[model samples]
Target chain A: MEQDPRDLEKAQAYWRENIRYVAILLAVWFLVSFGAGILFVDVLNGVRIGGFKLGFWFAQQGSMLVFVVLIFIYVWLMNRLDRKYQYDE
Target chain B: MDPWSVQTWTYILVAITFTLYIGIAVWSKARSTRDFYVAGGGVSPWANGMATAADWMSAASFISMAGIISFAGYDGAVYLMGWTGGYVLLALLLAPYLRKFGKFTVPDFIGDRYYSKQARLVAVACALLVSFTYVAGQMRGVGIVFSRFLEVDITSGVLIGMAIVLFYAVLGGMKGITYTQVAQYCVLICAFMIPAIFISIQMTGNPIPQWGFGSTLSDGSGMYLLDKLDGLSQELGFSAYTEGSKSRVDVLAITLALMVGTAGLPHVIIRFFTVKRVRDARKSAGLALLLIAVLYTTAPAVAVFARTNMIETVSNRPYDSMPEWFGKWEATGLIDFTDRNGDGVIQYVQDPERNELRIDRDIMVLANPEIARLPNWLVALVAAGGLAAALSTAAGLLLVISASVSHDLIKKTLRPGISEKGELRAARLSAVVAVAVAGYFGIHPPGFVAAVVALAFGLAAASFFPAIILGIFHKRMNREGAVAGMVAGVATMIFYILKFKFGVFDGGQAAAAGLTGDWWFGISPEGFGAVAMLVNFAVALVVMRFTAPPPAAVQDLVEDIRIPGGAREAGPAPH
Candidate 1:
């Protein structure tokens, strides 16, 4: 049996969309963890959230929450893509 | 008998559970070569996620990470950030595509994609390098956790853990490891959270471990646990509990390096392959993140609770009045209290920086429940949790090593004519050999286990992440490009690490002396993984532009990998 070229192209397209989302998430990941947590910490220290400093939250807790959301979003989005492309399996 | 009963029973119970899991894995072992390496390709998404969690959560996360957080204060979130943040990259960027490609091993994906055996070989080398370093650390962690609880020598502890891990991994192969890891994840999480709940209840009257972190201590001072921790840190000349002093740039770089490194790690990606479908891979990653968050979220709270309790108890106490935990941990060489002022009392102060004692950071997390005079069973539970974390991760890493040697090196390169049974035999043999080597390294670790573990992450970030990312996304990447990128990234990282670790070239006692020579872009060797990854991308792209595209057949193979229908057409045999 021969292989289908279009199937491969579709896969590549899926790959591109996935990568785009990941890259964006990576940027946010960088911003929240390093940006808010460390770089802008002094500025963020002025801003408080529920008795906890905002910057400290990013360093200790906020970044982790973002990561969890990112993964869940990725899974949900990819599942939709998988179905759209008839690659549900 | 009572002291040993809970501790001994926990070990025995965990051992029996692991044995049964391994037995089940063997019974459901993969049938074909693909099955042997990646399961029969029918794992449910949730189960796969559990397996990945088991694989990803190591001794560090299970045991030492909380300890580090307890000691390092807010700065310790680096582990939480780097480890969890990397999964975003994995789920969004890596897992789905790798699943779509549907390869048995990472090297398999690279090899077929690049149309170059050379590319595959380079990947195999990187996988071996990353896996071995990581496995060595896990083995060492297993030994440490066992030694502390079982009252056995570190060497014996390592050997015992190795024997059990080898049984399931070799017998069941990837399928076996996958299932066993799920069990491991359960054991580890339960063990970790149980102790945490008890300690939190004692400290804050809150049963929810995660929320208990922000609660006020029982002293009626109205100060939150973290606030008290910040105060103690200042008194000890340490940075505030919620603040770090390292340059924002360096911390950013290190965190980025860890995230990318986590995504690129071979052992982690391999877990995705165990599931049957591409969608399952995506779901698995999400599930893994959720399971890990259980511990990552609770860890900081544990650290804060432990730190505040330790300070409040020890402050102004005469040296002779120090608690039993001090002596117990000090015997382990993890806790050291030095009275610089000779004041006849343990003076924990944040000012007059020279007046402080340096306690090992790893001691804070695990020893917290014990330090607070929690029950003996809770301490035993912590020991079990630590063992689960170390052993599961170690088993996963050892599988990578064993697979690379038996499947990639021996079968792919050396002798393809070996029968399936013979190959399985070789794979099992390799597993045993890998365990022995890793156990040796763990017992005689090079430096601090946690620091050395960070270097492994750096190495993975530099070498494997780039190659895998490029192989899937860039169709034009050739053998030369992949090889050049991997070599450049890994070599640069190694040179940087050696300079600092062994004092190679110049022993720079002065920070500035080794700054330029050792560091690239002012990022420490521990944080250079990000830099290495960038260098890999640039090198691969440049090299590919100069080189030709992969052959038509390889391109077609990529297309085939993407399409689900052709799997049955190509079938198991390569005609």
Candidate 2:
């Protein structure tokens, strides 16, 4: 168990921040996949970028690219958080 | 076949690649249990990323997904999105935490977290069932590829595949499988991308398939590729290519099920364990998805290109004018054309009775190079790529089976006193048995292999996903809640699968016809996994409220895993 109050607080702060990042990122995940890809697809199909409709693009390709980007962003943010909290070895 | 024929080229490419794989396997044979199970837990993020991508992309993704997409059109997004999106969940929601826990298998984490052997047993059974269902399909895939391309009978193909998998999986274990998978990833990706690029350049002026997917055709028509497809589909009495035919709710449910199921799979989860640190786990998951996206994003373009090319080539063309591929594939029974109107020309329309052409969806990918009239070597590359995909995945699934039996079942539960050397021996023996059984299924596949494969995803989504999530994130979750939840989840999924998919109790094969229209909430049996997973989450939370709180030790372990930094320095949590 952590004896120092500051250490405990820092850990708690780090975890809270991590969860917040997850929530925000997952919302984007939900938006791209479930939102644009499915629910709003018909509506978004009205808009086109060359051969790809906005929704069709999201469904087949856009959402996947975003997913890859989202993970790397999470990694970068979490690594920075660890440094900020002095959790880095 | 002549010496310079496509068949000759396919044989040479297949032989050279197989020898390369066997050589790699021999050089990297495993010596210890850690080496066997997790590649000594020292694989680089890049290599692990490639291996995971290769392992996760089975024969379905490589050989069949594009074909399915070609037939399904807009409805195919469910698979494209479902498979790729799950990696986000894996990286963010699971991987780092699991790595911090730092065990060999998923069962070890679940059993320890819930603090019950019974929970572990539930997990092990689920893993074995899912992995076995999956490996059989892969072996069958290998047989199909060989039969179609190399002119080898399916049984020989399956046996040869079995021998190769057994050699590496039993000898080098995870160490051999991981490195070999990395090489397979290279072969498969190159095989997949080269054809896509060639075809893309042929269709559109753009060389980038992803961009070419959205570009206007090179036929000097300003109409975009997708627009042309949609127009052609409507002209032929099929629905517009960009518009889905399935109900929206069914699409949502299927997508969600596939996404959750991908994350829950034991073989996928174990790949993270091979990497050393928590961050490596997260980074590698990203890399895996990116690599997968290379093939996935290209598929839609290929689908559009092939669908259009096929329609233009033979839609109303005369029987005598039909190309060589027409008769070749027809002999394979994937394509059949009859002169329904007693006219010499073929009628490949949407009206079933008037339609003179019958084409199996799998032919799209198999006949793609021929459709494009590409060179012999590109066709051969596709065969080699298909084999790499099927074998890599089969080897991965076999390892999961062997590990579940030897490490989780025998060492942890049945005989905790077994020596390390003894356990390693058991793992190898289990792998050998697994390869043989998988080969059997490949040769004499059950009639319901496809349905059972769907059930494998459903089972993973229902049972393992909820159990593992609650274990990692919920402090109050106890043995009773987990055990009850897993059992309830799996039972619900099985009941749905049997009732709708197999129709075991209803009317068997006869009821299978009515089953599609009779789905609950209009969600098909394949999509029922999401509903079942929700049921699992509900049952677990409700059960946890009544059960005694977990011990303090379990909570500490959760805390330790939550922080992604220096898991080693934290030391193991007391059980």
Candidate 3:
């Protein structure tokens, strides 16, 4: 069966917005983890919080906490995108 | 507590959990192939989340991860970040779309998306190889736990585990496994948390393990827990607890490899197919992360507590007056101490040449309650928790292997004329045979159980992750590109691992001579998967540029999956 032309346009628009949200969220994830956690760890290590170095905290505990939050954010954002496109179930 | 009472408690707790699983299996008997394969797509999001947690946290995570952290210091964060961070990729990029595609297995998605039987066959092969490697480790874990608790040999313990798994898995399939996994998750988390809370309270006067990780010690010494640990490590010639020892590049590679590999695992991906809607898939991934984070966050605390307690308990002490727990573990060969230099005192240090203690990493979680002198019931509960983690993962992996063989290979490719009943029988029969094979490997393991399991993640990362991602997000990728990419990726990983780990083609030398100066860019075999996954993406993109684009119907299928609406209930597709 052929989809209506109007529905196709809506689907394309939904896809575009979904990709935008994913790209942005993933960039934040990479920056917090691989960037702050590893590459720039020396610079961040000069700073300390509690018993942990700033970079070391990101590597061990901070990145994972951020990952969990990022997923929930994506879920919330995509739900909004789905409602905007009339595709939510 | 006497040894007799400990044994009694272990038996009673383990028996109760097993009976509960058997009861659930009988109650959830599958009536149709769809019910057997994907649990009729009726699972709630939260229940699926709990089941995924139980299935994902294998014995390695429950039993050995803390031990690794205790020893490896900051380098252990690779596992902490790698395993949990992958859920973000799953929730955001993969799970919902795969659920919308409404398939029973990963091979189904790859086959349908590529519009080629050969692509399906390749996916099935990869899925089977990865699952088999993984199930072997779970089975070995079951053996280890049983041998410790029941005082039985490893081989007998493995056989008993195989029988229990076979009874439930063949009878109820995915439906039984799902409900049983929910129960197992409860048992494992409670078992894990009780001891951690006890140790935290004892050490830092804090009940929350996460907070206790940063709080000062309760011993009238104003020192923070991490600070004390760092000081102890430095005194012992070890790296600081908060500083990593591995090269930065290798750590990055290993972390990326584990993240992508976790996202690509067939057993994990199949859990999303059992959910009712695309939104449930997304929600379940989030819930699974929350459930998993409960343990992941607590583990580092356990690591710190165990390391500090162990050092204070044994350091500068006379060997003849060591704690009872030390002697018990030493009898089992897991903990070995020698009074070298006739000093009559034990010395546990970082320098291997002078170290007088050798402890297997697997003993950390199991011995935590004993080391802290917790009550007898909690110790018994640890045994049951270890079994739950191992059995749930083993059953999940066995199901994936059976489905790939019966549904993907035999029915889809060789005999499309087969009836639904015939396919169901094939799946059950294959599961029994797979269990037997896994049992054999568990008895006579190839190498260190945990290291072998790590290779499974590497295999998945190199072979499946890139192909699956491109299929979902890149509409122009063709069959030739995916097939070639998968082959190259898998072949490269296998060659590198075999040369470094097993010495397959290296003139029959037993040592890992290839891992020295000859290593590729200083990347270990465990971290090479990230590089190979990159190679897969590059090959697929470059090859697709020269090949014909996938037909329009395939493109439409990809487009349909990307949306969250119109997901059909998972049922038997028309043959």
Instruction: List each candidate's DockQ score.
Output: 0.57, 0.80, 0.77
TM-score of chain A of each: 0.88, 0.93, 0.97
**Residue B349 displacement (Å), model 1:** 4.9
Of the candidates shown, which would achieve the greatest DockQ relative to the real structure? 2
Docking class of 2: medium
lDDT of 1 by residue, A1-89 (tens): 46478755777787677567667877887788778877887799888765477787777888788878877776777667767777665
The TM-score between candidate 1 and the true structure equals 0.92
lDDT of 1 by residue, B1-575 (tens): 46555467667755766666667777766555666677667778888888888888888777678777776676676778888888887886678667767666788777767666777788788788788878888887878777776778899988888888877777777777778777888888888788788888887778987777777776677777777778777876778888866555667788889889999889998887776666667778888898888888888877777777887877778889887778877888876678887887887765655444556766676677778787776676777777778878887888788878888788877897887777878888898898888878988886645455666888888878888777665667777888889888888777767666545556645333546443656677668778878888888889878977778776665555543432331114543
lDDT of 2 by residue, B275-339 (tens): 87888888899999999999999988888888999999998889999888888888778788889
For model 1, the TM-score of its B chain against the native B chain is: 0.92
Q: Name the lDDT of candidate 1.
A: 0.75
> Alpha-carbon error at A33 in model 3, in Å?
1.7
Q: Can you write out model 3's per-residue Cα lDDT over B1-575, one digit (the tens) per residue?
A: 56656568889999999999999999998777888889889899999999999999999899989999989888898899989988999998899999999979999988988899989988998899889988998899999888888888899999989998998899999999999999999999999999999999999999999778788899999888988989998998989988868888889899999999999999999999999999899989999999999999889889989999888888778999887778878877999988777798989998888899998888999998999999889999999999999999999999999899889988899998888899999999999999999999999998655455657788889878998899989999889899889888888888877777777786637434545456688777778889889888888889999999999999888888988887977756645
